[model samples]
Target: MRAYTALINPISGGGRAAERWEPIARLLREAGAAVTVCPTRSREHAVALASSAARRGEIVVAVGGDGLVRDAACGVVAGNGTLGIVPAGRGNDLARTLGLPDGDRELARLLLDATARAIDVLEVGGVVVPGNVYAGIDSMATAVINRNRWLPGALLYRLAPIRAVLTWRPATYTITADGRTRELRGQTVVVANSGSYGHGLRIVPTARLDDGMLDVLVVREGRLHRIASFLRAAKTGAHLDLPEVEVSTAREVALAADRPIPLCADGDEIGTLPATIRVLPASLRVLAPTAPRQSR
Candidate 1:
């Protein structure tokens, strides 16, 4: 029987992560797996717990959202252990990218029987991000979401963007990708390892987890109406067609702004630019379906 260590965030998804993890844990135990549950006190605690468990050759499962998954992944990478997910948090973008099942039984089955696949992750200042790293308006929205955690996920995510857009102004950015540099005034810059974020929005539709490359997207400054249209189009990945939108692929990306601009990974703000982000090719081993589900 395999040994598993689950690090669960007590307050993720408005206090739902713990509630969701119960059934999953029961199922894993019933299947003869040795299950250990650790309720994480904070992000740093989660990383520490996962790292210690991983060093013992136990599969470290993050039973929360992308933020928790990212934290656990950092520990797994540090200890060189496999990572698993239960997707019990708001904005479970990484789980969506890997096509992890939603139901408790299916999720437990996946943890027990799925094949581990190697995927790329973004590294910024020693932090491993399993989803996209972004700046500008989207980062602002992330701040809003963080502050208003009491609101429902769908409603909060939708409203935060509108709040951010209202006060957002275009910033001059100097972006370097694989040594190629460009200076532009833009609303946002996203470097993606996973295509979806903001509750399934296809921000970088062409991005792939195993590609060993980062998909860089820049939304050039536009009028309010045009920006709104771009956001709507982004829902289906049609924003790539907009003239103001530019897309490229690179192994390393550097971002700097004329003024201080916050950068976010997964769903939490990391720090202000200038920041250097690199793709750690095939650095994370995750328990996912053999043939992964494609993001729409």
Candidate 2:
């Protein structure tokens, strides 16, 4: 992968990734690798750049947060090139979950020399949201997106799972899995494909990226204030042990609603939705090890 092309979002997270641009370029030149870096003008441009590189069989790197990575992943997954990350976005959730290094140089080495493996991602109508779990249901689903305003990192997240719990409650929604369909009221309906969502919060700790199945996390219905009460319960992942919380798995998921629900993919809130998501197992090639513990 000496001939490499990177699609970097300079404006992402206010140019955090761009901060390392020049030095990284210098190092790559010193390493005798041919490198080309391009800044994305918008969200859609990320995929356009990635798609162009994929068709050319070039090593494509995404230098932003999970949203940019997910966009690039969609572009390169069907092609023959490896999809890489630079990790400069706010959440960096996908990078943390994948056990990738901090920034440019480390990422360059990984792109140039590391072994690659195909990993699974949840594609909800062409948008790829990162993480292993899709928690909450219908109106409760909007609660997860609203929770993003909580502090921002790990310590804050220790308190986030419980945020707005009292103000929010489960809603009635139809769910289908393994050919079984039922109507249930729940606060969140999570689909887990990986363990944690950056900042070290594990919604589903045992998830695997290549398993070809999505782990489902369901929390039972509750009053608006009761949902807020779970703030403390979420700290230890005890929310899963609740009578309302149910775990299941499936190859595909479809969510339809009479009202708009906040939907986020890889940390970038796409829109409110009635949508479908499916597991594309071992779809995109990864440069790092198979699991978090196995990564060097």
Candidate 3:
């Protein structure tokens, strides 16, 4: 039997993950498996636990949301071990990309069989991201949303961008993608592997995880009414048709601005620009369903 480490973030999903870990662990053990449930004391702790277990060639399963997934993925990728996800996080955006099943029965089946698929990763200034890397107003919005965790997750996520655009000033952004350089004043810039972020927003609707390239998107600064319309269209992915929106594909992207701007990957703030983001193609082995499902 393959040994497994379930890295549980107790505080994720409003503490629901911690409360639910016992049964999940029991289920794995009952199936004739070696299951070790590791409750993460902190993000750094989760990294250490996962890294140590993965280095020993154990399957490291992330049992929380995107943040925990990112940490566990870092460890698994470093050790070249397999990664599994439980889809218990708030966004579960990475799970959405992987077409991961939400039910416990399906999850157990997946962990046992351990179907492996190579997926692309993003390296933003040194932080490893399994999903998307973004910056500018949206990143600022993420930072703001983190501070107001008392509100419901969905409401806070949707409102943060609107609040941010109202007060956030547009900056002149210089972006070089695959050696082609361009400068524009935009509200946000995104390079995606799975293309989804900000609580189900299809920020890059056409991005593919194994494409060996990143989908680069830039939402240009515009009048308030125009920006509002752009956002509305973005909700349904219709914003791609707007003239102010530019989409392209690249293997690497470097972003810089006149002022220091924060950057985020999979919703966690990594650092500020000027920074280079590159695609590490087919780098991490992810345990996904045997049969493919529609990308959400």
The prediction achieving the highest TM-score against the true structure is 1
TM-score of 2: 0.83
User: Best to worst by lDDT, what's the order?
Assistant: 1, 3, 2
Each candidate structure's TM-score, on Cα atoms with residue i matched to residue i, is: 0.97, 0.83, 0.94
Native-to-model Cα distance after best TM-score fit, residue 99 in candidate 1, in Å: 0.8
Off by over 4 Å in 1: 292-296
What are the Cα lDDT values of the candidates?
0.90, 0.66, 0.84
Q: Write the per-residue lDDT of candidate 2 for residues 81-197, one digit (tens) a residue.
A: 688777777667778877887666786677768888778888777766445434343233334534554345444444444454545545666677656777777666667777556
Residue 268 lDDT (model 1): 92
List of clashing residue pairs for candidate 3: 65-89
Report how far off residue 165 is in candidate 3 (Å). 1.5
What tens digits encode model 1's per-residue C-alpha lDDT throughout 147-209? 999988888888888889989999999999999998999999999999689988889999999
lDDT for each residue of candidate 3 in 139-206, tens digit (9 for 90 to 100): 99888887886788888887888788777898899999889999999888998988888778788887
Which candidate, 2 or 3, would have the higher lDDT against the true structure? 3
Stretches > 4 Å off in candidate 3 = 226-229, 290-296
